[model samples]
Target: MQQSAVPELAHTHARPIHWVATATAVAGVIALSSVAQPGSATAAQAAPGTEAKSAPAAAAPPSTTGVTFPLDCGPVKAIVVKKATGDLDGDGRPETVAVVHCDAPMGTPPDGVYVLTRGADNPKPRVVATLVDPKDRRTVTDFALRARTVTATLLGYSTADVPSCCPDLKIPTTWRWNGTAFVRSTTATAHSV
Candidate 1:
């Protein structure tokens, strides 16, 4: 008996090919492909019983799309207050920075700085962002908003024995608006208060 070389060659060369076809009334027939390009019409077309809804364009975040404020700011209480007006958003319009004495815990007296922008929808200004004392060890003794930089004076103690009623050490810090929020940009040493 002669070994059959022809039969073995035919079996080795022959392979099955699989194809899938999906049909939809609106999108017509589509053949599935492994490598599909993004944003292509065929890629976006819905399959079979499904319908495609167009995606909406991306909207800018509130912090980027600066709003004008005369917003209903609700209720706010402050003892020591100061206001600064300038173009903090880089826009031509002026933005108001309100530095107010905020309610704090028994040991700490913190001051809050509020950034408000004007809006046409309401006469009141809209509050955009607020910055309070960053650390818990001390209270905000004094603060000033100038040229977009918020400078604050912090009063604390160098030794544990010092009384919390009146802090002996004074630390000065500076925070600047970097588009999104006020970040502490500069740090200074403590001095006698």
Candidate 2:
């Protein structure tokens, strides 16, 4: 057997008191860690000399239900065919773009594209703009709201002789809020359906 040059230290041995001291030290560290906490996080820092202002809570999009659209649907009730929501006017709140039409028993009813918005004080949604009038005799299709713009494919007749059952002209249209009003623009050339 070979002999060691140095003797073993007393601290190296696992005594009951050593375990109690280690447990007490670990417990103290855990207790101190539980008492300490980090500050709340923020997205952006404010400019110098200005107080930090928290952003307002997000608002829900305007609803189309019970909104009396300007369309004159004789005896039948007007129904919302398609709806999309976004901040159309660069405002903090969202506006709803709804494609509404009469609940006719037969034949293709022309759709009315209406922009609806709810005021901060008013809870009910109101029609703000009429993008497509039902009187134009156009049916709305592929309607959507993207990048603060409203887009839709309008199906219409080229002339009075054209049958209502079969629309001849297809127009890809888009409406954008231009500070004061909703400006209409065509994305592509009109084609026959």
Candidate 3:
């Protein structure tokens, strides 16, 4: 069954980030926009050495796994979180919504996103997916997230380099978050959706 997306940012998933408006992703070399020290999804573990988020955690965090490290992006460089939401699981728990960025100065590299999620058992933050702007047909931005329940951007990015499948069909795809895993929704087969 499909439900309202966790973020509630954009109801539809057909809209993409308007990079031109902000002139944000200027195709520059990737760099560390911000460093988010890891946190324990569980309430038991106190954040002693973890990096602090701009926002404080309310109540208890969900269990989480560790994020993938040393992520290779062919030519992509440092992957960083651009934007994120707090709750996603709908258990009165906050899920993470991260906007990953890549590309920077010379030798910096291209850009990509590193999404993380909190699990119930592990308690450590887990890398959900690393998204890259699909600038080519052979290569498209594929999201890899923990899958607890995710809501992707609806706007077709002006410069995100849309893959053949995304634009051709031009629809929305829902990812179902099972307690233990995530499953792609098959309700709409709009080729793009």
Candidate 4:
């Protein structure tokens, strides 16, 4: 009598599948490790004593110009945000954006978006605007300056009404220079992991 061979054939086929899955997993880990490494350009240059500088150089800043902030918000204990510079006002000069974070009560420090411009005397690097308030619950997660537009990514309180350790929502907002000030051009929100 001839016995069924299906069981033997299935076992042989499953072995190759298992090997393939293991090989794929190993390849994925290698790729992730490469990305996890530091210093691959596109990093953020934070000022001394600021944690923001730790972020990878997120593309070369639009000409440092050696400009400095006029108003010292405080010691930059942490850099919650770092945005590249771009010619926002069409003045042929790039404007930089930085949102600094310092230690304070309620995990809500006096963090503000400092828009820096490299021009003028007395205060060569004067702040164009300081957008911050004591009542805001959103924190700057990331930012990018491109084509005279500044896009800020913010993490805000979740639907549970509690300020969790991690952001539950991501809000991407765009601002454009309207000859005088940066105006909101677009905005959208999504659930963050």
Candidate 5:
């Protein structure tokens, strides 16, 4: 064997102490990396010479709590079955569309859909419009708020002879605000269930 020019280094040989020191250094590097993280990336870039202005926080939709609905439930209290929120009136504030019905013990009670909004003058949420009245004997299903429009599948009876327990007709309906009032438009003809 030929003799090497450089002297044998202690680090060249594998030792328990050397392994422990290397493991400790690796663990320290992992811990430091975890502690130091990059900031979140954003797509929007501010123009030069102009300060970036953060967008104003949007107002929360009106809540159904503490708001009295126009329902005449003799004994049972009115309960909110389903709800959706969106900007309906183009006022930047969101409105809550709630499907409310009497908490009947036996039969399926009819549902009433109401649009609720909180005005600047009044802090409490109030029903601004009644999309579906309970007196109409329609049950709201598949309800949604999309693109400032309220859409729903209305389950109703074809005639008075149809029992309340089962709805025979299904109608897909949508309501949109026209600056004055909410105009209701049925997307499809009523069909048998």
Candidate 6:
């Protein structure tokens, strides 16, 4: 995957979102793949032999189209808040982090992460913070959020391609979401461990 040139995403965050196609916003049109659609429910309960009006129920096919989205970079993440810490900004004070993580959506387009942290000035309610990946995998080892300050480790963004959605073309580049739109961040080979 390649890195995107868009800098706005330098301090943004990314999230894994599932877009379901209804009449409005649909993740994508899912076709038959391994998982088969189920039969429709009979409407004979309410009225004797009334034809069912709803569409046939289909089995949720296994997530096939694995999306390849880029994430975790400079300005790419506005701020990463760690749970368990009572404060965000330093100075023996409590802070509320408000970020616009809109880039969390899937795809090479740079997404944004909108985060909001709130606390009080007097006898504030200390909220614990815990950050993790889509797989619920723990990332931040341990840290504290002080007033106007936040500390954490680097983010390792992974692809969310199911191959089942857009099988013909699985994005080969690292796509990023910069708050409002998608941007190619960088190629997977650009950086190394």
Which candidate gets the maximum TM-score versus the true structure?
5
TM-score ranking, best first: 5, 2, 4, 1, 3, 6
**In model 5, which residue pairs have backbone atoms overlapping below 3 Å?**
none
Candidate number that wins on TM-score, 4 or 5:
5
lDDT string for model 6 (63-132, tens) is 1122122234444532233223222323243333221122433433222222223334323232222222
lDDT string, candidate 2, 68-138, tens digits: 99989999999998999999998899999999999999998999999999899997899989999999999
Candidate 3 per-residue C-alpha lDDT over 1-193 given as tens digits, one digit per residue, 9 for 90 to 100 = 8895776665354345554533555433233333444665774554889865567466454232334433445565544544444444456565554444444444323233334566656667776654333332112233334335444433242334644234443324345556644454533544333
Ranking by lDDT: 5, 2, 4, 1, 3, 6
TM-score of each: 0.45, 0.73, 0.36, 0.50, 0.75, 0.20
Task: Compose the digit string of candidate 4's lDDT tens values, residues 1-193.
Answer: 9988756655456677788988999999999998899866785577888765244433333332454443344544444345576667886556677766554545554345667765533435556676543235567756777787777766766665665565576767777778877777535556575
Reference-based lDDT, each prediction = 0.57, 0.93, 0.44, 0.62, 0.94, 0.31
Poorest 10 consecutive residues of model 1 by lDDT? 17-26
List candidate 6 stretches off by more than 4 Å. Answer: 1-92, 95-138, 142-148, 161-193
* Candidate 5 per-residue lDDT over residues 18-109, each given as its tens digit: 88999999999999999899998988877889998789798888999988999999988999999999999898889999999999998889
Clashing pairs in 4: 42-57, 42-58, 42-59, 43-56, 43-57, 43-58, 44-56, 44-57, 46-53
Compute the lDDT of residue 38 as modeled in candidate 5: 98
For model 5, the superposed segments whose C-alpha errors exceed 4 Å read 1-13, 17-55
* Global fold similarity of model 3 (TM-score): 0.36
- Between candidates 1 and 4, the one scoring higher on TM-score is 4
Candidate 3 lDDT for residue 4: 57
Model 3 local distance difference test score? 0.44
In terms of lDDT, the poorest run of 10 residues in model 4 is 56-65
Model 1 TM-score is 0.45
